[model samples]
Target: MAGLITCLSVPFLSYLGLRSLPAQETAPRTIVNLEVIVVDTESKALEALERLKKGEKFSTVAAQMSIDPNAGNGGYVGEAEVASLRPELRAAVESLQP
Candidate 1:
């Protein structure tokens, strides 16, 4: 009887252990390719936006007007984990059509 009880409890304990473990993420991690043009003032940012709307190449405007160090590289900020981005930036990225 003791051996029977031990056998039953072993399976029960294993089940409980499995239940206690965190759920694994089955989805693949998302990566985002990003570019940015940082400027000191809102007006400058607006100007950049207008240029973009007018069909000016982003790399060109970034090279000429961005104050960021990456301006030389056309404001290339590199790839990032979408989950690791700031909330506002994540929202903006998510809103894009592509």
Candidate 2:
């Protein structure tokens, strides 16, 4: 009986050592919708860059022509920065194209 308990206890102790919780990797993820529109031309893009250099905010211009339904009201890009913004949206904002 003692030997039986010892054998059973060994398995229980082994289980205690072997059992483990899964390791989770938490990564930063920002979700964004993929819809975007391209501005007309390089000249338009350059003009917007000039405006930015002149101390203008890109969002203000984007609000007028973003092609998103909210553009007229406000570009309202939410939390995105230029570098992280949707490619076309960034281009359109910078270009301020009609």
Best by lDDT: 1
1-98 in candidate 1: lDDT tens per residue?
Answer: 35542211112247447434333433567898788899999999999999999999999999999999999999888999988999999999888887
What does candidate 1 score on TM?
Answer: 0.70
lDDT of candidate 2 at residue 42, scale 0 to 100: 79
Model 1, CA-based lDDT: 0.83
Clashing pairs in 2: none
The CA lDDT of each predicted structure is 0.83, 0.53
TM-score of every candidate = 0.70, 0.37
Q: List the residue pairs that clash in candidate 1.
A: none
